[model samples]
Target: METELDIEEESDDAVLGSYEEPVRLVDDAAAEILILWATNQPVVWKQNFFVRQTSLSFSLDACGQIFTIIQSPSAMVKPGVTGAVLWDSGVVLAKFLEHAVDTKRLHLLGKKVVELGSGCGLVGCVAALLGASVILTDLPDRLKLLKKNVDANVGIPVTTRGYVKVLELTWGDELDPHFINPFPDFVVGSDVIYSEDAVVDLLQTLSQLSGSHTTIFLAGELRNEAVLEFFLEAALEEFQIGCIDQKRWHPEYRSCRVALFVLVKKSLSCM
Candidate 1:
């Protein structure tokens, strides 16, 4: 059964999501416009569509080079709103933790990794170039832009230490066959567990992707009390949780408190 809100939402999205080819003006200037995926629905990939209000910047970081996407007041990927995005929810924090597995870091030895909800694929981009096999996952709608980000940044193939692969994975949907590894050795996500409706699907995906030796790294801004409660309950099955780190994204940045959580999957022996 669907609620009235859901019904109306679907209707609006369908009506708004009509697309045609890019139109060219009399001069050489041209503009590309596409359907909004599902109008009024939350944007599946924030980086894909070119909106007038935003710009992407490549920033140098202590860990390595990562892209910074800045959102502005006039930017309207949607209607009447300004959005602040640090990194894709699962990607920004994953970038913070990359030292462990990155060859340049000299700490972690494993190179295989995956990031869910990779909005701009910054973390995966860095990892793949640093000599690890990295898989970047997000919705199909975003893959076009995600691929663009990869192409825009990495000029040479990262054959020495890393490889980047983009995958389309919606929360709760069945896992794609691209990953033959069965369970990933390490799963890192950031800011991914915010939506209450999407929590169960997220947990289900995590459970299916982790093993006893697997390390699951998560980072998020606490949206509200309900979000925290949902996480406590959803990921309780396989993970022996530990609150590893917490901090603000920027010193003066308000409403942007970030926390890092490390959960080790406990198999029968550990239990």
Candidate 2:
């Protein structure tokens, strides 16, 4: 008893249900070259490939002010070159900080903030924009690009407020007088927890930089459960740890595979 209209409707429904989104394969190297050309930045030829700049935009608030960061291209397996590029966890943490400030959950206005492993300084730039006096730190080789990005994005000091500085910090090294004399009110790290061999050194550095009143925020990709567990196990000795709820972050930035943690020095009473 089915009419032609009924049959056509059924066919349409089946077609729609079976439809799949198309996937586009991209040549990463070629795309980097194109991006470099469009941005008018000089390109370097290395090992039969082009090294170029990558531009990223981060929103500072609901008012639509954005921070732009320029960074060199990076390779996943390249030795000693990870800090030249941007990473997803950095973007997520930047967005999370913006969200937190917008909601008044965490106040950064006029606070002293330090960012560890500030690869391209995206998170630190965003923090500076949010009114925190920020110190961006990384290895010696990485400081050049980090400073470039910070200078380009943050610009000159504004009326003695929201200043940004770049410093070299090697994990487990002797504590510098500047880092120890005035502990940062806040310590932040994005995607700095991947290396198992460096965890102890990192913890030592963090302990040296943090105090009872200092708050620490760490955002990292949950790629290896055992590595993360090892960090948490070691960190528990000094810090009281809690994970930020993923639902509280901007929906666009929410990643089930990425986690943000808030840590505070454990009080003797609580320990």
Candidate 3:
């Protein structure tokens, strides 16, 4: 007797539980970048045909800060070196985090945070600025650039106010207890949900890093709906998923192509 809409609502409730409300935290400029990427436009990149090394600057209005990221030229980036470049979703997420903290929608002060697939370490740096101890992780080869950006923006061996550390984390590998014993209060990722082959591993890593009190924020460009759907299906098994409303952020950042999800550990009963 359930209508399609009823069934859909029930399914969403089952997967999302009490966190069904959308929290807006994206801007229109960020939204436009995602749209361009979805349409195969080169708005974020410098060269049309090839990737080019470039320096880019992002402004955090809430804190009146600017981050300069050095992007490796596409020519120098070999296979499996995608993390050398900054992506639009990363920028969007960084901006959203800044907006969230400014508006008091999310608290990062005195919290431990981890960023997965932290290309260029922009989001991690922003987290540090917002008063969260941050661990930025990517593949081993990508650590150099990631560390450079983090150090350049956040300084080395940061103090108790907020610290930033770079680590090599290959998805699906056994998590190190030393790095995650207490579990971070918040986990963040940007443009990480691309490969169909990597989705399972990515979800596994997320599950391992999350505790009952942990919340995860993931922002990804909608390149392939099927791939995104696959990730959501797998993620639902371990976490309660909520979509953050575009309206919660600056009007300039809302995008039809860029999506943000907030994930929390599912209750034991639900599990």
Score each candidate by Cα lDDT. Answer: 0.50, 0.66, 0.69
Better of 2 and 3 by TM-score: 3
Candidate 3 local lDDT, 123-188, one digit each (tens): 888888888889899988888888888877788555567678888999999998745888888899
Which stretches of candidate 2 lie above 4 Å from their native place?
1-64, 74-77, 268-271
1-271 in candidate 2: lDDT tens per residue? 3111111233321100001111111123234224324432222312211112343332333224655566566443477676676666777788888887877767788888889999888888888888888889999878887888888778768226667889999989987787767777789998888877878998998888875457778887655556777787788776655556566576676654566776666552242
Model 3 CA deviation exceeding 4 Å by range: 1-62, 75-77, 157-159, 268-271
Q: What is the lDDT of residue 195 in candidate 1?
A: 67
**Local error of candidate 3 at 250, Å?**
3.1
Report lDDT (Cα) of residue 55, candidate 1.
50
For residue 169, model 2's alpha carbon misses the true position, in angstroms, by 0.6
TM-score, predicted candidate 1 vs. hidden true structure: 0.64
Q: How far is candidate 1 from the true structure (C-alpha RMSD, Å)?
A: 17.4
| Native-referenced Cα lDDT, model 3 | 0.69
